[model samples]
Target chain A: MPVRVAVDAMGGDHAPGVVVEGALEAVAEAGDRLAVLLVGREAEIRAEVENRGGAEDDRLRVVDAPEVIGMGEAATEALKRKPDSSIHRGIGAVKAGRADAFASAGNTGAVMAAALFGLGRLPGVLRPALPGYLPTPTGTCVLLDVGANVEVRPEHLVQFARMGAVFGEFFLDREDPTVGLVNVGEEPGKGTDTVKEVYEALRALGDRGAIHFVGNVEGRDILRHGADVCVCDGFVGNVVLKLAESVSTILPDLVRAEIGRQGLGADHARTVGGVLRGMLAPFDYQAHGGVPMLGIDGTVVIGHGGSTARAIRQMVLSAARLVEQNLTSRIARALADDDAPPHP
Target chain B: MPVRVAVDAMGGDHAPGVVVEGALEAVAEAGDRLAVLLVGREAEIRAEVENRGGAEDDRLRVVDAPEVIGMGEAATEALKRKPDSSIHRGIGAVKAGRADAFASAGNTGAVMAAALFGLGRLPGVLRPALPGYLPTPTGTCVLLDVGANVEVRPEHLVQFARMGAVFGEFFLDREDPTVGLVNVGEEPGKGTDTVKEVYEALRALGDRGAIHFVGNVEGRDILRHGADVCVCDGFVGNVVLKLAESVSTILPDLVRAEIGRQGLGADHARTVGGVLRGMLAPFDYQAHGGVPMLGIDGTVVIGHGGSTARAIRQMVLSAARLVEQNLTSRIARALADDDAPPHP
Candidate 1:
């Protein structure tokens, strides 16, 4: 059976054009293995799908959702007032069992609100986390609670570690992916009381051979590929994620300036520029498609606000993969199976 | 009339050799305007000075302190155990009115301990902060509380903004440097209770024109030049500093890989590689020399653990600049003049 992913066609900067186009691409690429439920205003979505020559495709369906959620509106307030909004309708499809997953690139808080209110939390899941993935030379490093929960307790961090491990094992295809608690220093007593307590919990799990805990990892290790999952409070994780993205954007410009300063002729510099562009192509967030809202009852992948057609396609594909891989069930199992101590 | 900077000769990975050699370079560069007090074991300091050809310079002085603090030693524990340690002796010079400032590349916690316990906090300065500077394309961004105060209150954040402004005006040479409380989001009520309170306090300061407060800035803004100074808790600031440094280090390799993927001939790729190396040269931590510990009564610059002679020289230069500009008095004035709300 094709995994049906409900996408908010009205979401993100690109809107119906890129979102509808991306769904078409994902459907075409997956052939019969994937179906997309485009949740948004029926008129724009229908026009976009028709323009893209996919109006007749049985795999693509448009769910009429006339109301919209503005990017700047308060998420919880918007959720209550705009029940017919794309975010609400899309996630609602997942709750109603009409779609296996929901994906959006709209206001992050709105998406999180939709997931929390619409689908509710999974069994034993304290808080849902936004797991942001950073691709390195060796492998990918997953940072959890990127923005889902700004204020976190020790147990929440431990839960994030477990969820990250399950996600890593499934996505990276690694056996027993290592978990590391992000801290200022690698020492045991480095961070605040919350972090220290989390460290002790994770460390105890490692001792019991329940998890392959790599102890404390500093911020630089986000790119070091030292561990499969790096867990921290959403505030820290969100900051690191944004700073890293900025670094990727700034690095290329710095490289270009250096190339210009090399005293090379314009033509030669242009040639080198093409090659360097190809090198940095991987760092593009579009390549990863979207970040997953992990630990929720249903799968939800959040793309960048400025998501391209390909980026939208990637998000749809990610959602399908998660649904097919039984991500939610596996995460639930992983959490339930764990015998680690709770908050001290 | 010379500004004397007491440097921990025993600190840093490349110990007495780089430290002594750096002091020699600073002496040569500063002429008679600056003097360096090398604090370490007398024998090693003397040999290094002789090797660096600065044995004849009267501007350079050797202060004997045989006790050494290992990089791995617990800061408070080591401070009590090794009273004769270089950190203690170096700061002792400042306390005893023998040196105008101090610089070290040793264990960060140990240096903070020496400063707090030996010299104590300046009047009205609740806590001293380790302010790390990130060099952006436009200018530099100062981040405070990188490690000095892991546990920070709202007042501490408000105070850091004042100190950062003074440091920026003197060091970065910016007129009325802008300040931003580092937050997960740009919205007013986005983060924890503490962050919210800090935001309100900083916003009020901006309104009063007491400080160039830019409200809340996200992680990506650290290198955006949107604000000259970014304030956060020690934990977040430390993560950001290390992560940004890692990105700077990792960006080049990623770029090279990107260039290699273009399938260019070995010679052309080599040429491109050389250009990139030059481009990324500035991102090197060694280029920045050292970070100044702000909000203290005395000037203290903290360098990286793996400090080279060039890095050490930069640290000394930074310390000299701070002293010559009378950074302490300026910070004290900035805080005393502020009309911001106290901690709730």
Candidate 2:
């Protein structure tokens, strides 16, 4: 059976245009194996589809979602105020089982709020979290609670560890991914009271074979890929993600300014800039695509507001993979067996 | 009178060699206006001074500090165990009025612990914090509590702002430097429970003209230079600082890898790498020198463990400036009347 995906076409900075093109691309690539419900203003989506000249696919259906919640709107107020918004309607499809997964590049808060209220949390989960995919030199690592629970208890962190590990296994396609608690130091007794408690809990969880908890990791560890899954409170995680996102822009600007300062000719500068961009390709958000709201009862991925057509296409594929992998059930089972004694 | 500065010659990775060279440079430049007390193993300090030639400077004195504290040792325990360590002796010089200021490139925790116990806190200060200098496109911004006070309250953050502002004014040489609270979102209401309270306190303080509080700033603000001083609890600040420090190394490596992948000739790669290194000069900790532990009763600066001769020289010069400007008194006065109504 085809795994149907709902796309928030009205969401994102370049909404409808890139979203439509991306949905069309996913439908074309996946053929009959995947079906996309483009949820947004039908007229705008149709116009975008027509502009792209690929409107004849049966697998791609434009489902009318008249309202549009802005990128900066308050999640709860916007969702309650605009019931027909793309984020709401898109998530509604997942809740109703019309679509196996939901994806959006809209307001991250709204997407998360919608997922929580509509899909609810999986069993054995304390709090849901947004896991941002960071591209390290070694490959990719997951930094969770990127914008979810701003204040998390020790138990919430333990839950994040289990969920993050499962997601890491799928994303990295590696067994026994290492989980780390992001802190000021790598020692066991480091960090705030909450982090200390979480560290011990994670240690206990590791001993039980539920996860490969690799002690504590500092901020540099994220880029160093010291652990496959790095977890922290949403407040810290969000700040780190934003800073990392800005590095792509800041680093290149510094390089360009340097080239100018060195009095390099325009021709040489162009070649150097090209090489620099190629080198920084790994930092591209479009390549990483969407971040999944882990612990949700169903698959729900949130992309950057400035997502390109390529990013949207990648998010759609990622959603399909999560569905096929039965992420929610796997996470539930992992948490359920967390306390059982290790098999002999 | 000349400003007397105590240098922790046994601290940092390079130890006596770089410390001696840097001290000599500072003394030579400052001439009779500066005096340096090199606190470490007397024999080792003398050997390094002789190895570098120019050992006839009368302003540089070698003070014997027989004991040493390893960087990885527990801060409080090490400080107690190694009473004769360079960090302890350096701060002792400042406390005893033999030195006007103290500087160290040793274990950061050890330096902070020694400063707190030795010099105590300025009047009205809630807690002392470490302010890390970050180079931006415009100039430098200070991020405080970089590794001190990992868990802080609203009042502590307010104190940080007042102290950081005083430091920023001197460091940036700009009157009324802007102070920003590092948080997940730019909105005042966004962040953890502690941050929300801090927002209100900072706002009230700003309204009274205690500081030029710029509401909230995200992680990107450090490089964006959104504010002259960005404040956060030590836990978050330390993480951000370390991650930013890693970028210098990571970015250069990525460029080299890209050059190799592009099949660029070795000659071309070397030239490009040189240009890249020059471009990244601002990020060099050596140029920024030491991070001052603010709110302390005396001027105490801590340098990176991997500091070079240039960085040590800068730290010594920085300590002189702090003493000359009476930074401790300025911060003390800033927080003393923080609650007083605005002048008519």
Candidate 3:
């Protein structure tokens, strides 16, 4: 059966336009292998599609989703209030097995709330995690609970590690992905009680070949490519994710300042900017498209609100890959094993 | 009385040498204005001092503290087991009224532990915070609970704001520094119950000029120079601190990659490197020296393990500024006020 993916066409900064463009791009690239259901206000979605020339591919379908959940709206309240929001309706399609996956670039909390309430949780998973990738010189590192379940239990962290490792193996195409528990210090006894317990549980799982535990890693290790996957409570993970993002925000100013410091004029600086842009491509957040909301029963990808058409395309493709690999089922199978260490 | 500052000469990675050089540099710059007590193994300190020539001024003192505490040791256990460690002894000097402030580039947890047991908590203070400076092109921003109290209550966060605001005024030389509560999102009702309550408490206090609350700030708000003082529980603060530090860690390699992409030889790249380093100097972690351990009874500065002689010098100068300003007393007075809002 062709893999079906639901797109939140009303989500993100440049919503219907970029989202529609992205869905069309993915269909063209994936050919008959992929089907995209653009879910949003029917009129807007149609107008966007018509603006870009009618949806020429039979694989592309527009589903009427009348409400739009804003980027800054309260996730739970908005989800409950706006039943027809692209996020809600799109996620509902995945829940009902009409779509194999769901993707959005709107409010992260709303996307997660939709996953929790609509698509529902996977077997043996208490809290799902939003896992994002950070570019490292060697490749990429997986970091989760980036913005899902901000207040997580110790056992929730263990589940994140198991799920993150499985995701990493398929996503990064690596075997027995090494998992590191993020903490204040690298030593075993450094962090809170929750971290200590999670470490012990991960260690137990590692001994049984369920995961590759790399002991403790600090925040610096995430970008340093220290492990295949790094797990932490969403609070800390969110801060790390944002802080890494700031590096991009500041670098351009630094380069401009450097040109000024060297007494180079605006024209000279603009020429230098082109080269610096190429150099900075790896640091761009949009390159990754979106981060995945894992531990849910269906594939769900949440991109930044300012996502570009290219980023949307990347997000659709990523969700399609997870769907093809049966990532959610793999996570469920891993968490279900009796040999898996019990959460604290 | 002349302000006496105790230096942990055997603390950081580049101990004795950088620590001694830093102390000497601070004394040379301050002349008769400040005094530094180099506390560590007397023989090693003396040899290092003599190697660099005996103290140039009487303001520099070398105290005999025979034991040393390693960085990775558990804080509470290390403090109890090694009373003679420089961290314990230096803080003790402050407690005994022999030293007005203490600075260390060693173990951070050990420094906090020393402040808790040695100097003791200030009256009306529950948990202390470590406030550090993040340099922006415009100026510097203050981030507290950097790594002091890992887990904290809403009241402790309020305390952090009061303390951090007072600090930014004297340290960054701002009047009524605007305070932002570090959170996942900037909206009114984002984040956990603890964050929401802290927002209300800060708001109530802001109405009274207890703090200049600017509402919630997301992770990206930091480093963008969003607020003067940003407060959060130490766990999230620590992650932000480390992730920012990675910018310094990775910038060199990134510059190298860019130069390689430009097809420049090693010699040309080295020349470009000198210019880039000059531009990147403002982003250097060492430029700020050490962050202060605020809310304790005495002045305490905790620096990075990878501190250099210049960093140590900056650390000494920073602590000296706090001692000169009577920062500890100001914080004590602020917390003692009857109108101070109770923890939510």
A1-344 per-residue lDDT for model 2 (tens digits):
88899999988999989998888888878877898999999999988888888674557888899999999898899999999998889999988889999999989999998999999988767899898877777787889888798998888888888889998998888899999999999899999999999898888888878899999999877888989999999988988888877787887778878887888887677768878878778888887578788889999988989989999998898888888988878887887783732221
lDDT over C-alpha atoms for residue B15 of model 2: 88
For candidate 3, state the interface root-mean-square deviation in angstroms to 1 decimal: 2.1
> Per-residue lDDT of B1-344 in model 1, one digit per residue for the tens?
89999999999988989888887888889988898899999998898888766674558889999899988899999999988998999999999999999999998889987888888777788889888888787767888878777788889988888888888787678899889889988889988888999898888888888889988899887887668898999999888888877866776677666666666777777777788678656677777688777777788889999999899998999899888888888877777774643333
Local accuracy of candidate 1 as per-residue lDDT tens digits, A1-344: 89999999999988989999888999999989998999999998999988877774568899999999987899989888998899988988998999999999888899998898878877888898988877777777888878888899889999899888888887778989989998989889889999999999998888877779998999888788768888998999899888877766786677677776777877678777787667556678887688778888989989998999999999999889988889899888877774753334
* Better-scoring candidate (TM-score), 2 or 3: 2
Question: What clash pairs does model 3 have?
Answer: none
The local lDDT score (0 to 100) that residue B315 gets in candidate 3 is 87
Report i-RMS for every model. 1.7, 1.1, 2.1
How do all models score by TM-score?
0.96, 0.96, 0.95
Per-residue C-alpha lDDT of model 3 across residues B1-344, encoded as one tens digit per residue: 55788999999998988889888887878777789899998888888888887663569889889999997778788888988889888998988889888999998888888888787778888888888777765778988887777778888898999899888989888888899999877777767888888998899998887778999888887888778999988777777777776777687787777777778666566555665676668777777788777778889988888899888988888888888888889888888877774453
Alpha-carbon DockQ of candidate 1:
0.72
Per-model chain B TM-scores are 0.95, 0.95, 0.94
Which candidate number maximizes lDDT? 2
Worst 10-residue lDDT window, candidate 1 chain B: B335-344
In model 2, which regions exceed 4 Å deviation?
A54-58, A338-344, B53-58, B338-344
- Give residue A279's error in model 1 in angstroms: 2.0
Query: What is the TM-score of chain A, computed separately for every candidate?
Result: 0.96, 0.96, 0.95
Among residues 3 or more apart in sequence or in different chains, the pairs in candidate 1 whose N, CA or C atoms overlap within 3 Å are A279-B258
Instruction: Give the candidate order by descending TM-score.
Output: 1, 2, 3
